[model samples]
Target: MAGHDLGFQVVYRGETLEYYRPGGWVFFQRPKDCGGGYWLGRTYDGVFMIEYERPVSLSDGMDFLASMKKVEAKSEEFDPNYSLF
Candidate 1:
């Protein structure tokens, strides 16, 4: 599938992220409830980075997500159940 056929755009910090269904999913991790943090997305192109406009504080938590060094992955390695959310 091509990007235009089944793609979605994600807007963050006034930036647009063009994601395609055939390109798999964009994966990233950010801080939780400790002011505004950064959002990094691992897409078929490269690591997508975004920053919040303002900071907001709340409960604190930490989570580490795997980094995608390269955009291309083996078809068998693709996870159907995987999602960025």
Candidate 2:
């Protein structure tokens, strides 16, 4: 971790870089030592503001995730005679 200037080094999911672009969000996964692996995530709404900040912690990460909307995928209806074409 020497010479690493990042606030917190994240494993960087494939989509993590998306946040650099407009209309994208990013999430960072904590190391095992950081409370058995939890996620520290944030959505980039492209807005700037000033507010309080604190050192990242597992409990805080879980609380943040809890406030964010959960993602769910929709499944297609099952069909006995569905065509592959």
Candidate 3:
């Protein structure tokens, strides 16, 4: 599934950021005035990164949150030794 290709990495500042997805998702680690909001997207072939600004609706945020929850849940099902990191 597409979500399987989606992963995340913690940046140097300790913020958890999404990565390697077929398409990007917007992330706001801070308020807008601080340039805190940005879109992290993937290329059409899902091999590159694209950053941009776009208004994200509440429903879209909810959906992304739900997907994140699922990812977390799945992570719990794995054996500790299986962790790639």
Candidate 4:
């Protein structure tokens, strides 16, 4: 496993957590909502869409996530695309 220390955005409900870099794949490991274990997030296309990975335990999840840096979403000028509206 390569060092997973790339600045990524934390995805909250409704916020567009889209990003990319010129490298291999980047992923995120977060605690599961059900509280059993944790789930992983990955990219799809160019947008930062979250794809799940095999579930891991809490301790394992934290350790895996720790390997990667956490970045809170930064969209000071987050404007919605309302072409449909």
- lDDT, model 4, position 80: 80
lDDT of 2 by residue, 1-85 (tens): 1102322223333433332323222335444565444343333466422111433444464455344434212244467898999
TM per model?
0.20, 0.25, 0.30, 0.30
Most TM-score-accurate candidate: 4
lDDT of 2 at 63: 52
Which number leads on lDDT?
A: 4
Q: After superposition, how far is residue 5 of candidate 3 from its true place, in Å?
A: 31
lDDT of 1 by residue, 23-74 (tens): 4433223345544444323245554433222332211111222113223344
Better of 2 and 4 by lDDT: 4
Error of 4 at 25 (Å): 7.8
- RMSD list, candidates in order: 13.1, 12.2, 13.0, 15.1
lDDT per residue, candidate 3, 1-85, as tens digits?
A: 1233334221222354344334544343334565544343333353545343463433454466567669978886757586567
Worst 10 residues of 4 by lDDT: 1-10
Off by over 4 Å in 1: 1-12, 22-34, 38-63, 67-85
Alpha carbon RMSD to native, model 3: 13.0
